[model samples]
Target: MERRILFTIMLTSFLTPFAGSALNLALPSLGEAYGASPAALGWVLGSFLLAAIVVLLPFGKLADRYGKRRFFIMGNGIFALTSLLAAFAPNLPLLLAARAAQGIGSAMTFATSMSILTLVIPKERRGWAMGWNVAVVYTGLTLGPVAGGFLNYYYGWPSIFIVLAMIGGTAFLAARRFLQEEWYEDTSPHWDKKGAVLYGGAILLIIYGLSQLNSQPLAPGLLLGGLVLFFLFCRYELRQENPLLPITLLQGNLPFSLSCLAALLNYCGTFAASFLLSLYLQSILGMTSRSAGLILLSQPIIMALLSPLMGKLSDKYAPTKLAALGMAVISAGLAGFALTIHNLALWLMIPMLIITGTGFALFAAPNNNAIMSAVEKKHYGLAASLLSSTRLVGQVLSVALMNLILSLSWDGLSLQETLLQNLQLALLFFALLSGLGVIPAKVRQ
Candidate 1:
């Protein structure tokens, strides 16, 4: 039963990230097919992330009140359905909408999967279980670019969506067959509608505003409005008996708060690496999608292999220290990329990717263990949700920053030159951002 539950959880974990990483390889193809701009291609990715962030906390709270297994199953179904719809989308608008709906499903699954694992696994083996879970996620990322590239080269970009639908369906079936238990912290019927609206609205406004910074005159206003709404959301949540987020967790718990902050910084710094690289390889260097995907495999392959080992180590050592060390390595890797961007060679790029991947593997599983371990069992769902939310928020910021750079620097230069400049600036900024995370990671209890 334990093995079956782990397998089921792992299957669900693989699907969303596979789609995300794979889509990076497909972006140039997608842009050419739709005659879309770089910002628009960024939206294809950001829309899904934004939607997932909006629903994650609410779904996490709701899963705690209702049942996680139920939401997990529903998420799989919605993801599969949306993938099918996205495959047939004739226009970019329809495709973005479908991807947004898919994000809601991803939120459901992301909010619940780790909580379920934490509930069923014993303390001694918890890190090991989490390790394998993180491993499969890296595995998905490892395969996505290769498979997505191959499919896009042969059958077109729509085939990637078709493959995602099949994977989602398979995961849905596995969950139905293997997961028999339902887990929930409370059986409450009361809902926090106001808190939900404020949280979701704030995230939407902020992300949308950030994405529009290069084009919109009112972007700053929208950003300020979003911050105001977020403040209101936090205040309202503090007053509520059943808040969307557990405010105390952030305010009172040192380890959990710092761990979350480290996660946010790490993701913000690193998540855009692939996005920038894909464009650099294909658009700047004129490599085919297949070739670019193969080159990109160096990072996640190392991550997939090393994550399980790091996870097991976290069981016996100080996870915070491991996480802090990992963040420093990631900063070094990003700095390597920044320094080498002007005259990059495969030998240099591959080594940097390997270093970055190693850092990610070291950081991901242990940081996850730290976050989940710091919280009580009852807040597992919320903790998982918050972790996922932090990741999405960072990812959104990373992409938005990339889009902003691409938008600002595209003038008066060739496309290749523009991309090179963007990559250089972005890598430097990310390296500095990642370096700052080490302090919080080291200080966290």
Candidate 2:
């Protein structure tokens, strides 16, 4: 039963990251097919992330109130359906809408999966289970580019969505058949509708505003409005008996809060590295999607191999220290990228990717163990959801930063030159962000 449950959760875990990394390799193909500008391509990616971030916390709370298994099944169903729809989308607008809906499905699965894992697994082996979970996620990342590139090269970008749909359907069936137990913290039927609206609205405005930085007249206004709404959301949550998010978690829990902050900074600094690198390889170096993907596989391969080991080490050592060390390693890797941008031979690029991947594995498993360990069993769903939310939010910001940089740099240079400049600047900025994150990771109680 334990193995089955772990297998099911691990299967579901593969979907989102696979979709993300695979899509990264396919971006250039997508842009050419749709005649999309870099800004529009950013929208294609950002739409899914924004939708996921807005809904994750709410779904997490809902999972706690209702049942994790029920929502997990439903999420897989929604994801499968949306992947099919995305495959058939004729226009960019339809595709974006499908991706947004898929994001909602991703939130449901992500919000509940780790919570369920923590519930069923014994305390002693929890880190090991979590480690394997993180490893499978990297496995997905490892396969996505390779598979997505192969499919895109032979069939078209649409085939990628078709494959995702099949995988989602398989996971849905497996979860429903093999996982019979339902886990719920609160059986109350009450819903926090107002809090949901306010929180969702704030995230939408903020991410949209950031994506439009220097590109639109209303960017500043949208950002200000989002901040105001966020403030209101925080105040309102504090007053509610059944809040959408537990305000006290952030206000009172130092370790949990700092772990979350570290996650946010870590993802913000590293998530877009693939996005930038994909474009650099395909657009700048004129490599095919297949070739670029093969090169990109170097990083996640290391991540997949090392994550479980890191998870085991975290069980014995201080997770906080390990996480802090990971952050420093990540900062070094990002700096390596920036410094070697001018002379990116395969020898240099592959080593840098391996270093970054190792850092990611070190950080992800230990940091996750820290976050889950900080909360009680009842708050597991909420903690999982919040952690996932922070990750998606950071990813959105990372991509938005890249979009802003690309828009700013495209004025007077050739496309290749512009991309090179964007790569250097973005890597430096991300290195600094990762360096800053180490402080929070180190100080977490």
Candidate 3:
């Protein structure tokens, strides 16, 4: 019964992220079909990710106020509706709106998923359970391209959304049966309505500002204005009694904070590769969508197979050491792939992507465990949201930084080659920045 309940919670939690990421691989297809410019395309992607994180804090409180299972089902139901709308969207504006709606549901899903787990999972087994949760969380990213590949190859992009809707519907049904209704226990402050508006505004403005990087000339004046808004957001957040993020948690534990940094670094380097490299394989290497998906399968395939064992090992070994080892391996793989990848054989890219994929998978559970374990149980809900927000920020920055580099040095090369060069540099930077996280890892909890 416990396992059934946990599985239901995870399924509800991860369904949106999985679907969103899976749909990402098809962006170029969507762009071409809908005649979207690069800026519009960025917005298409950015809108979803941006809204998901920004809304998390508010929805988290709502989940606490109402029953988690109630909000969980409601969010998934909305996700299914928005996904269906996205499949039928005829114009770019409609698509953008639908994606934003999807993002809201996604944010709700992410916050409540972790909170429900905290409500149910015993602390002693959380480390191991977190491994499976991590694995499930990424299940979409791993399977998405493969599924997108087959669907886009034969069916069309709409099929992907239909599949996601069906999956979400199934999860909703499962939730109703397996989950119990738990009322809120905390006498925490009233939901921070003002905080939500301020945070959401700041994040959207910042993401919009970054999206303007390649499309519009960088206007220092406008960027300064956005920065001002960002600063005000921080000040606003600090004043809230039950802050969206428990800011105090940052100072409480070294391993927890540092582990988040490590994840940011790993994710910054790892996630960018998939985005940039997909273009490389399809345009530069002249491969089919299916072939690109299959070739890229190396990364997630290795992670899926090896991540569980590495997670188990983390039970015995120091998690910090495990993280460091993984990052070192990733650094080596990225550097080698950057230097060596040229007119390569089909079989070659697999080994390089696989090595780093294994590195990332090995690092994930240990890092999440380190972060969650370092914090008190009482703070798990907000802490979980913050951890995800941290990761999303890193991801957004990576995309913006990679694009800025590409635009600066573009010498009339095709988009594919330019994309590769940009990512090569991004990977190097990701590796260097990841080392910074090690400082906090050395401190014992």
TM-score of 1: 0.93
Q: Rate the local accuracy (lDDT) of all candidates.
A: 0.89, 0.88, 0.71
Candidate 3: tens digits of C-alpha lDDT, residues 277-392: 77667866789867787787778767766766776677777767877777777777776666665644566677789788877777777776676666675666666666677778
Clashes of 3: 0
Candidate RMSDs in Å, in order, are 2.5, 2.5, 3.0
For candidate 2, lDDT tens digit of each residue in 186-232?
76668789999999999889988887777799998999999999999
> What's the TM-score of every candidate structure?
0.93, 0.92, 0.88
Candidate 2 TM-score versus the reference:
0.92
Better of 1 and 3 by lDDT: 1
Model 1 worst lDDT run, 10 consecutive residues:
402-411
Please give the ranking of all candidate structures by lDDT, highest first, separated by commas. Answer: 1, 2, 3
Clashing pairs in 2: none
Error of 1 at 252 (Å): 0.7
